[model samples]
Target: MNESKEFLKEYDDSKYKKPSATVDMIILTAVDVETKARSVPDKVLRVLLIKRKGDPLVVDITDPYKGKWALPGGFVNYYEDLDAAAIRELREETNISDVYMEQLYTWGKVYRDLRRRVISTSYMALVDSSKLNIKAGDDAEDACWFDVKITLLEEVKTQIKAGYIRKTTYELSLVNSENEIKDTVIVTKKLEGRTSKIDLEYVNNPSGLAFDHATIIFYALERLKNKVEYTDIAFSLMPEMFTLTELKKLYEVITGKVIYSRNFRDKMEKQKKMVIETDEWESGKPYKPARLFRFNPDWVEDQ
Candidate 1:
């Protein structure tokens, strides 16, 4: 043990370079948008973004991407934990806290940052927007929730020797509260059977989300879609009491696909422990009132 301690003491700490660590937050919520009917609103999935006040790559005064929008995040402090850093950054940048968030993925690409090597551990969060008060702080010039829409543009598969390559392109659009298009990001992802792996790269991003955030947002959306089918994650974005139709709409909006009413109802019925019928009905609607239900707190432990 003494020899080991002596060797450790003599070892040089600067022999290897370390990459800076950061935490990027993907804060998602469902907001009610006014449709033709003012009583019944349409639920839309929205993501929170912050406009950078300065260039992240350098201290250059005239950087074009300085004012670009990106995820709320910052460099992790040396003495802070990763999860703690995520929560801290989210609160500091957007004044959002006490939401359900989990580590989604770690992104480390050599060219991801132009200034220095940075490895980001991203977290995904789900919250009911009506419950929180948000304000822009820290290095954020502005912050707002943008409605998210994703469209599949093209897909092609090519056969190669002993393998195949699949390429897919998608377009992501962010709409502001005034019902106008804020920005659009185009992404191309390639899946190669030779390496049994998938890779994503940006094709065109007019929104100018800093770094590889466009890909990160796309990844978080895919993760949410997959998890909603099996996990109770959808409940986080729901109100305390909601109708079955409202629940179905939430699922459809997140998945970006139409679900059969009969099928969805049957599935939810099977999970009897998940929701409980409440002696309540929705009000202020154009049509007849529908019975309301609430998520069962007892089943949360099992979920």
Candidate 2:
């Protein structure tokens, strides 16, 4: 121990250059898009984005994506943990805290950041949209929630000796009606054997999302879609109390599929035991009042 301590003291810390670490947050929510006053609302997924403040980096004289939108993120402090840095950056950029976030992925592509070498670890969080009181941080010019829609443009599959390769292309659209911001991002996913990769370019980003955020958003959306099928993660985007219809709608929106109401209710209530019934019913609807239920966190254990 004494010899190791002496070696630690004599070790040179700056012998090699290291990449700066940062954290980006993909904050998502489910929103009810209103049409006519009496029409039933349409449910859609929404993602939070911030407009860059155009501040020059210490190593650069100008910002590459100044005044454009991006995921809420910043450099990680020297003494902070990765998770802590994600939470802090989320709060600072969007005035959002008290959210449950999961580590999505780490991006370490060279030249991803123009100014300096940066490695970003992304985190994804789902929240009830009604609870947000968003404000732009010092590094951001504005904060907004854009309705998200991802559409499959094309797909192809090829058989290989070892395994099959599937390639799918998707168009991700973000629209903020109130802000009049419409952004389009195109991404492609290539699945070779057991591995898959997402690719995007600056030219593919029509609305100027900073760095490789469109790819991160695409990855997070795919994760959400897969997890919502088997896990109870979708409940994070829902309110404390919701009707069976509302729950089904939220699931359909996230998965981009049409779910039969009867089958969905049966599976959620009987097989999964994901929700518990309450005596309370929905009010002020043109149709019959629906019973409200709350999520049962112990469903997995109970099963």
The candidate maximizing TM-score is 1
lDDT, candidate 2, 62-91, per-residue tens: 567777788999999999999999888888
Whole-model Cα lDDT of every candidate shown, in order? 0.81, 0.83
Q: Per-residue lDDT of 202-280 in model 1, one digit per residue for the tens?
A: 6545445777888889889989999988777899999889887888888999898898977887677655457788898
User: What residue runs in model 2 are displaced by over 4 Å at the alpha carbon?
Assistant: 35-39, 55-62, 159-161, 178-206
Cα RMSDs, all models: 3.1, 3.2
Please identify model 1 stretches exceeding 4 Å from their true place.
38-40, 55-64, 178-195, 204-207, 271-273, 298-303
lDDT of 2: 0.83
| Candidate 2 displacement at residue 151 in angstroms | 1.0
Give the C-alpha miss distance for residue 178 in model 2, angstroms: 5.2
Provide the TM-score for each candidate, comma-separated.
0.89, 0.87
**Pairs of colliding residues, candidate 2:** none
